[model samples]
Target chain A: MARPARRGGGYWVYLIPSLVLFLVVIVVPFAMNVTTSFTRWSGVGTPTWVGLGNYAKLLRDERFWASFQHNVGLIVAMAVVPTIIGLVLAAALFDYIGRRFGTRTASALRAAYYLPQVLPVAVAGVVWGWMLHPSYGAVNQIFGLKVNWLGDSDIALATVMAVMVWFQLGYPVVIFMAGLQRADPALHEAAEIDGASWWRRFWHITIPQIRPEIFVVLLTCTIAALKVFGPIFVLTRGGPGSATMVPSYFSYLNFFQKADVGYGSAIATVLALIIVVVTFLFLRLQERDS
Target chain B: MRTLRAPGGPPGRWAVLAALVVLAVVMLFPFVIVTLNAIKSPAEYSSGGPLSLPQGVYLDGIVEFWQRVDFGRKLWNSFLISGTVALAAVVLSVLNAYAIGIGRVRGRLWILVFFLVANTLPQEALVYPLYYLAKQAGLYDSTLAVIVIFTVIQAAFGTYLLSAVLGQFPREILEAAALDGAGRWRTLWRIVVPISRPTLSVLVIFFFIWTWNEFFLPLIFLISNDNQTVPVALGVLQGDKMMDATMSSASALLGIVPAVAFFLIFQRTLTRGITVGAVK
Candidate 1:
């Protein structure tokens, strides 16, 4: 049944200010970035049209492909790996720890896990940099080892991925905890009464019950992984060689550092398109599932 | 509460508790280590173990970090930018949320969908064009440029949140106000804002923390040394060949202290904001 409508035709006026700024700052520039991607231009002078040239270069560019490879690695490292780890941690907190102790303790523990999410990436980078320093860093000396954490090309990306995983762990934990709240207790009880072990019940009942939250975590964290720039900017500056360069960093380097605005915009547009497409696909999948 | 049984009574429960404690320690230990090293001299840092206490209350790391990083200026700039964005963003969101939510404006559903998409456009996507625009406007190096960009970003989220809050406002109250000849703006300023204080506080707190921590836009826009926010300013401390592990440790501590303290203080509200925003 439809509710009675409020009396107003001028209500659109209230939305004007937010809409204007949003369009100018976000929508219009987004359109400009799309057009700029097609042209050849440095940051200065005037733009010259060279349709498809940048995209052609982008496709053939080894660094571009390598950056995508790193992004895929990041997907596994930051999004996929963390989701699995966070789920188990969250399940333990919800099913075992919190159930045994109390929610107060469980939520407190949740906050502790959430510490990394609160700090800015720059700050987290500094802390990690201090810890991962090659010579006198705490992590190396503590283990009585020497490793170039942010330098050596072979392992710097892996190191950065590890940090992103750490930063992302808490978000899913909290979201999953809350998702668990809405789960039906009956299913868990039924599984338990059938003499299932804790693992069995969690596998059959808990994961299935909170499937939507898993998707939520996956989609959000994956987008975050794609846009990861801050920590890289601080910790490694895309590193000793181009080891940790993701598309986001690649774009910034091309734009500000390399002064190839067209190429930079192309990289950014490609990355942004990927994020939007993946997000759209996930949302559609979610809609279909429900 | 007992729908799901604990597998075993005490032993199993204790193991789970121990595991959780370990997880918490793993999460929090980095902060503790950083704090311990912040006050140590570079010599103490190198010679002693990572966990060793400073021999003498040496504070050179923090002192050097303070003098070198333009610490006070960064804090002030962060404060000003975050405050301005929070205030302005909240007002814009409140007004927009009011029209679409309480006023039940036509095409309200479309407006909400528009913002949902707008919110996801990786803000980095716009940094270039914004850079170009700011340069043209002579706002390239100004804090105003950062403020203007961030306000729009935060305002998008704020609209969604405050809209939900406004939608819950009792109709009878608004009807009474309308009957009293109060106009829309008047009813809003007089009634809706006061009653929606809790949600507005949530929006403001979230915006304040987000803007203060915002790095990319400010990093690109605010190029001047003194104009950068806390995160971007502190970012320069890392990877400097001359800068030691001690200064990095100290800067890390300084960078996190404010956000962490704010979190602890308003944790109840902040936690609510997270869960609400998530489950929505």
Candidate 2:
């Protein structure tokens, strides 16, 4: 550690390349998003300054609100339901599987559960799209009924959410398993000695201990849900009267399909702010805990 | 086997096992369905229903799907793009992570904060401007666009992973390398890298899977068919006339093989990478 000055120089020097790339690819574009959202750019010619016109339009855009509602629906499907199920599954595995089978079985079970996460989003999208194809799709055949899984506007968002839940379920299960592993064994044994039932012990001991993991799962899943595109992009394509539309894909459509770059940028910028704000909120909670 | 404790405990364990098995089946449902459907002829898929066994194993759907998409080129394109980006990301991450993570530099914490925020920013926010930029630079519709975009994004994530690797380095080895009169570059290349190879492989795999799965950037930038990547090509095929249920199942199956195989092969390390990255 002789020449601390030169060492510092090397450190700062190494950050430059990645930083430059970050600034160019991320920072500059983000700044442009802020500016472009204020202008009417059709992505072909010069952008005209519009000054919050797009933002004003977005405030009243039914499709925008509908997509945002779908995002909320996605949150329920992708985050809340999966986290609940994942928690129960993880608890069951942690509390029971360890004693009954072994760590090997538990681990194998986790790997199996995480199988869907291994596949690319596009692959999942395509596979589910086929299975959910309203007419002759397998899902309907298997259910022994004619159900429009992806065609009915009323249920299309729900169907997409179901797929999102499936795609996202594995992530939380994995995280929760790890979190549950860190819980003190003696604490559980002590609770058991007090005649605590499985459900009660889990609620009192497991949930409180793994709150951080739950928060992490929730934040990640919520963000992922809010930003979901690939499955919707490939599955429904915002179909059945924009039923399954999400902010990310909606923004994509606005930019490319509608050729309304200014409005698209506005939608994206708002979504970006939501993510950042939520992230910061989570960070604050995490920091305060620490 | 002799009677003994199983895993988590004795009570309610069978129930947990049953539940896990159910969840596992749900998770593998798509894979099973795809595998069964992909080998079947389209007529069988429509007529025979979901649980119907293939009358004969007609592998021609996959064969035809392969040729129709000219998937060989797209496959090469995927490998080229993913390999190039993963390698670049790993290299850049090693250097950048060494600086902030191992160098004990001032503001290293702040630098990591910047990275955290950067990584959190969604691609939707950046793609529009990137589209405009790529067009002006004459890089639009080129594989270079996809490669560069993925490299930059993956490097941000890779930096976080590799930084953890550097953080876990044994100080003694680093000091020994320095005392042996090895320059920083030599120490990093020969000593630090050798020690961090496992973690580096984790980062590489992470980038490879992430880059291969990337869709939006290529969709926006690579407008032409020949330049499109696997996921983008697959995305286009989702809407194309030639694509059908059986054919797309074939495409989906083939597209996921490399990634899913990699996951199975490196499940331990990749799982550790994720849990360590997110939870820790």
Maximum-DockQ candidate? 2
What stretches of model 1 exceed 4 Å from their correct place?
Answer: A1-8, B1-10
What local lDDT does model 1 show for residue B258?
87
lDDT of 2 by residue, A1-290 (tens): 44433655666777778878888888998898889999998888799999989999998999999999988999999999999989998887776776567778878887778888887787788778777876656788789878888889888988888888888888888898888778788899899779899899999999999888988888888888888888888888898889888899999998998999999999999999999999889878988886
Q: Which digits, one per residue and each the tens of the lDDT, describe model 1 over residues B166-278?
A: 78789999888878877777888999999998888888888998898888888888878879889988886576787778877888899989889888998889878887776
Measured against the true two-chain complex, the DockQ scores of the candidates, in the order shown, are 0.55, 0.59
Pairs in steric clash, model 1 = none
Off by over 4 Å in 2: A1-7, B1-16, B239-241
The number of the candidate with the highest lDDT is: 1
- What part of the reference interface contacts, as a 0 to 1 fraction, does candidate 2 reproduce? 0.67
Query: Residue B98 CA error for candidate 2 (Å)?
Result: 1.6
